[model samples]
Target: MAHLKAVQGSKAPATPPSRPLGLPGLAALALLLAGLGWLAGMVSLVQAALLLVGSGLGVVLYHAAFGFTSGWRRMIVERRGRGLRAQMLLLAVAVVLFFPPLASGTLFGHPVQGFVSPIGVSVVAGAFMFGLGMQLGGGCASGTLFTAGGGNARMVITLVFFIIGSVLATIHFDWWMSLPALAPVSLPETMGSANGIFLSLALFGVIALATLWLEKRRHGSVEASGGVLPSDRSRWLRGPWPLLLGALALALLNFATLALAGRPWGITSAFALWGAKGAAMIGFDPGSWAYWQDAGRAASLKEGIDHDVTSVMNIGIVLGAMVAASLAGRFAPNFRIPLRSVAAAVIGGLLLGYGARIAFGCNIGAYFSGIASGSLHGWVWMVFAFAGNMLGVRLRPFFFRAPYRPAVKGC
Candidate 1:
């Protein structure tokens, strides 16, 4: 679907085509939603709504190919800056929307809190691992979910190990918690909202300009390709959307998440819970881990996936991606795995999972939501994560002569 660039230079106006969605896929989605509803029991409406939102997330992510790892990698390795610039735009939009409500401390009567986490060793070490793991595993947290949903068989390997590593982190959470750390800090709290916004925007501008300059210097010029007249399906459903549009959608949806859940969007924590539950079912006693000592965390371990917000959202993302991929006729899953690639996936996935836990979040929770919510930890995470990516990119050649398409080349 993506390769079919609009008919270049043809004076004729082609009739826009509609992408027929796969009926079976649509049916599957319906059944999944029903399952979610049933799982929620008394809170069916709220649960269903979140599930639908999750599905929408999957669709947008899949159709747009909204990427984090790849976008950063393209800038780092290929000197392409479009994706990075788009991300800055996303942060800009998110910060503007998030800060105002978060500063006020309430939104429509629901208490709103920013994603404030401690500024310390765990974040630095974990984020560094996450960054490197993304390159090696072939996707960041969000990337892994969308790709796995879109029928990329190798990502399942990453997802499984990601869960294992996340669960393992809980066992070691006490030691990391013991590390020297500052209290959770937020720019909106320290600096006034207006001042924080100004500072954040200015930094974003600086980074955006730096990318633009670097791209021009290395590539000699930006991409020369002009937009081909888009087809109708490309506009909404079967799509390779403008990266900026993807970014904007993500920002708005994240804002919606705050409104609905009274918290920002998150991803990896669900993986940890899911893995722990699976372990508990097998009598592994993941519940005894210090991370589960918290009453809420301990209780959540006993509940089903439907009881977990992140788990439901993660399911929605996967199912949504599947529906989108199926509609786009791109839902092919090749299960055959190469030996070296398998090793990379295992190592990379473990790193991604464990790092996310240690860092207090994944790309979604820690970096994007964290920064947008004005948490200084987000900035710290990005720095170390990028360093990890630097190493991970260099190490890729050892595993595969070529990286997976869904990994870093795109989301």
Candidate 2:
């Protein structure tokens, strides 16, 4: 009742069709899930559950066309704050939910930790570079995976180099961490929950208002987000979910992750780990690197990749998006690549990899999860990254087509 009323009151963009699930896609997804469960079950039931959660994440991300890169780009270029505003809403919800448990220090007897980190040179530089890369590479960490899984050939290129760059950065990760940085500060830890939550909400509101003002000044009116199209059924299976709903779904999912996993959601660590494993295949001993020398990390390195929580979830996200795209009849692979776009993908991907590695996360790990965990470094990340995006938007035209077109065109 409440959700329906909110939908009626709000304005979001018209969504693409919610088609029925194709039989082949459904069968494949089921088989894949079964296989993943089998693999993870070899480890533990908890691992299997995380795989399912990861799949749900991928489905929600694909069905919603949720793009962190696009969201920031739209706000910067078009002054359309709808996407960015939705992010703010997501953060608002996440913080409110996350703070209570994080402050308490334990949930269901499991020790829980937030993503608090220091504000320093490494983070500042990494985040700014990541912002630039988001435009150049065409997606953030999550965006790259989902788009690639959904059969964007160019993103496959991005994913490959993203791994290479991540591996390369491991060489200098020690130096970056050694640089001067403020102590890790959590808003909830430094300030009581009452003060932290209220202050965070106020900041969100202020940012939202500022965007509205800028949008109005630039475009003469605040743009309307056309709501999603109504459907008799099949909305979940075939989706173009409204951005707001996507935001809410993500927030709730993150909270669930915290509860289930005993930590906030993270992504890029898996990328770096995957890259390291790939290096080992060719006789490169990334295991000797300082970064992997930690007792816990070394043990994880020895275990198969699937044994790692983030790696398993990352795999789930890839497969889940593929299934979602296929179910929607939107899974069309395009191999044709322009030299200019490929150039962008290479450069952007390297930046994404290195930037994320050095910064301790990408948009998903450092920015989204960071902020939601009440880390001051998360807020610091946004400021520098946004600055990077300011310049990246300019360079984009030289490297890629001016705008994106759907695979089928008018699909």
Candidate 3:
């Protein structure tokens, strides 16, 4: 719908008014949110607020980094500007946050806890596939959740199929594990987490410089856009610094989450847990479900808090996103779903669920948190999923329409 905007001098332009939600709808939303908060044991109003705000901040951080990535992809590749320098700046921030001990002898809490070190072939292959998948899916795992919460019907479809793909992958986990792997590529024996971080920084620097130089020399040889949407410039403030700082804050929040929970950042595990719970309620043995088929290897859903953590965290994410959408006046209801698209969503969700199990994390857990923790496998999953995303994008026309037009030009 049209929104009114005041301009200089002329008669105030009339615009279509937004349909405010009715009292009943608002009441229902409040009740539902209240029930969710209760179930999650957010006993105090303050705790509830903190959870909502923290998770919302996390989502915002995610989008900010995403925005920067999209812009850099355009500017550097288009030879329009020095996007590489911008990326380097962000990476520099990541380095300081991830490895402060190099200069000060202390990283995030428990310096020993964050040191997973690097590996070889597994990481390389996983990174390639992960990148491809994320591109095709139109978003990474966490991205799917945020978009779906924002009422993007197409994202809902993509999420369904992501679950399907992940679940299917779980069904074949033995085969995947049997695939070639590098056991212990510890950095301590070679260079250590701090040293490895520096090495990575150096390598990224070389690549960034080369990319920018090539783009400038080639005169806009690479395509200006990829699977990502253009930016919403108005959504961005006067400068990009706020968004950049927001990302660093997100990384710090993630560190806190890890410290508090004694675990790493993740989202898909929550999805799987919810799926399992739903299955059990419907008379199915969740233990027999493909997604939970690997539970025997970890902790059984019946025996551990995995399902609880998943359910609570997933709800928090949805609620957090909902709150943000509402405050930003971006909330709406448009749940029209074509049969074919429904099928795609279900299939995709199932796959995404299973694959996350097999890979041990989705985008955030495996790719972001994992990489930040120095896990070689984290990098592997990222590369492979990205590859999967790339392939998934090609199949987009068959599954759903892409609707991510943003406000920034040439981004």
lDDT of 1 by residue, 1-411 (tens): 242111111121222344576764676578676767675675566666777778888877776678788878887788887777877888999999999889999988999998899999999999999999998898899889988888777889999999999998988999999999999989988887899999999999999889889999997888532233334545666565556567878898888888888889899999999888888778898877899999988888887777787888888899888887766666666666778888989999999999999999989999899999999999999989989988988898898866444432455
Overall lDDT per candidate, in order of appearance? 0.81, 0.78, 0.48
Best by TM-score: 1
Estimate, for each residue in 1-411, the C-alpha lDDT of model 2 and write its tens digit: 011100111222344454555664676588667856687658887778777778778877777777677767878888878778878988999999988888889878888988888889999999998898888887888878877777677788988888888888887889899999998889888897778899999999999999899899998998665454424356576566667777788788887788778888888888788888888898999889988987877888888877888887877778787888776666656676788888988998899999988887888788888988889889989999999988999887687454642221101
Please, what's the RMSD in Å of model 3? 7.4
What's the count of clashing pairs in each model shown?
Answer: 1, 6, 69
Regions more than 4 Å wrong, model 3? 1-54, 58-92, 99-132, 184-190, 214-243, 288-300, 303-311, 336-351, 393-411
Could you tell which candidate, 2 or 3, scores higher by TM-score?
Answer: 2
Model 2: weakest 10-residue lDDT segment is 1-10
TM-score for all predictions? 0.92, 0.91, 0.67
For candidate 3, the 10 contiguous residues with the lowest summed lDDT are: 1-10
Best by lDDT: 1
